[model samples]
Target: MRFVAKRQKEGVNVSDTHPLVEASTLIVGLAAIFAIIAVALIFVVELALYFVSAEDEANLFGDWLPDDLITVAPNDERLYQTQLLVDRLASHWPGAPYTFRVEIDDSEIANAMALPGGLIIVTQGLLNQVESENELAFVLGHELGHFRNRDHIRALGRGIVLSMFFAVVTGNDAAGIGIKAADITLRGFSRRQETRADEFGLGLVHSEYGHVDESWRLFERWNIDGSSFLDLVTYLSTHPETGDRIADMKRHAELERWPVDGEITDLSW
Candidate 1:
């Protein structure tokens, strides 16, 4: 008994590692290692997006989506007109491997998004905000640029890896992480992606309509008056500034000899 006490006091004969402690340490180590890996994956995907074109990437995610999430645009006159506009404008963009599919979202968010494999969603609030078909066409053209360059897939992968990092830190409960990533992914594109989309859309609109100035008018029409602090999210967080974007559009139109002012396309608004 005395010998045991002595040994215990010395701690030389005792096991230094407790089972609970070892387990917790292992979990922490794994979380850290995996977090690094996940971060690396995000960077890898960002780089990979440069080489991969739209035709090469295919996503069947729509099949897994429930009917409630996606509503096929009804045969309403507005939808018919929107579809006609999309089809006519899309014709000007070449080498599109997947046939474009447009659907209406029931949400009130004044926004749009592109998914992998030629999927596009336009929200109810977005439709309500557009003053004319030309404005809507600009919005559509931007989303199409996302599809054409496969920005959607790159963004999705980036979001997933980031969410994984969140899950690891949250002990695998990353619902908040998922929500944040979704908000970021859906609301705005990366600076490079956004610039590319703008270039694509502005060029397409110019090519199709002959006037590019009013394309920036959509920016003006999106009123943030009486908006809460949260309303500045897209403006503050990841997106390029709206003023800068309008200026860029003007400069680009000037460079391309694209019309900033000319006979504006007549839309039956």
Candidate 2:
């Protein structure tokens, strides 16, 4: 009986030590589980952002500019001509629907924009500054490239996703979080998307009219004669850098062997 008790006491001691080992193991296991959950949550948030951004882009543009605002000036032959150019370029994308609207804003902001649902807006300032139809086509093609790749939607998605991530991580309001996300998203587009748009825009210009130099010339004109600082604040707010973008356009043109000389059509809007 005494021998059995002595062995039993030894067993109890070993069992006590076993728990220390098991406790350490349990802590490590739990930590790994938490880490996995964190990673999974991050992925889920990113995926959710992608879809949310696309939807938000559609909604935001839809709400801001109703179809009623898309008016064309009478005798605006240039506006019609711009639309025709945009249509011809967009046709290359195969079943891509686009609408061109010329917003005659005398804001001195030389800019054109493509919104979702085939909406294109060109400031009168932009029309006035462009030297030729080819340069205008280049700008329009770049905007259309954005639409073709659904870049705005992707940008919105990235913003929403990032906002959700920060909100969840920091426990902030979704609205505030979303604003921060948008700020980040607009700071700079993905390098890949920017390159793709540049290439696509160059291809369109080269294919349609063979006026690749127009792209570079347009950028030079904007740099030299674009709106003043206060005027450009709004323009640069959306379009960050002018010089670098121009450089990129030039590089892409050279790489693609686009023609250096082509007549700039005298179509002033």
Question: Candidate 2: what lDDT?
Answer: 0.64
lDDT of 2 by residue, 1-269 (tens): 35444433456535655777886775666545434544454456557656755445455565355444444565677767777888888776665644444444444567776666556777777777777878887888887777777765555555565555556547544234344444444344455566677678788888788667577676676578744555456556566467888878777777777777877677655
lDDT of 1 by residue, 162-207 (tens): 6655655585453454445444544443767887888888888887
How far does residue 111 in candidate 2 sit from its true spot (Å)? Answer: 2.0
Candidate 2 clashing pairs, residues 3+ apart or interchain: 53-157, 99-118
Deviating ranges (above 4 Å) for candidate 1: 1-39, 46-53, 56-73, 171-189, 223-238, 263-269
- As a TM-score, model 2 comes out at 0.63
* TM-score of each predicted structure versus truth: 0.70, 0.63
What are the lDDT figures for the candidates, one per model?
0.68, 0.64
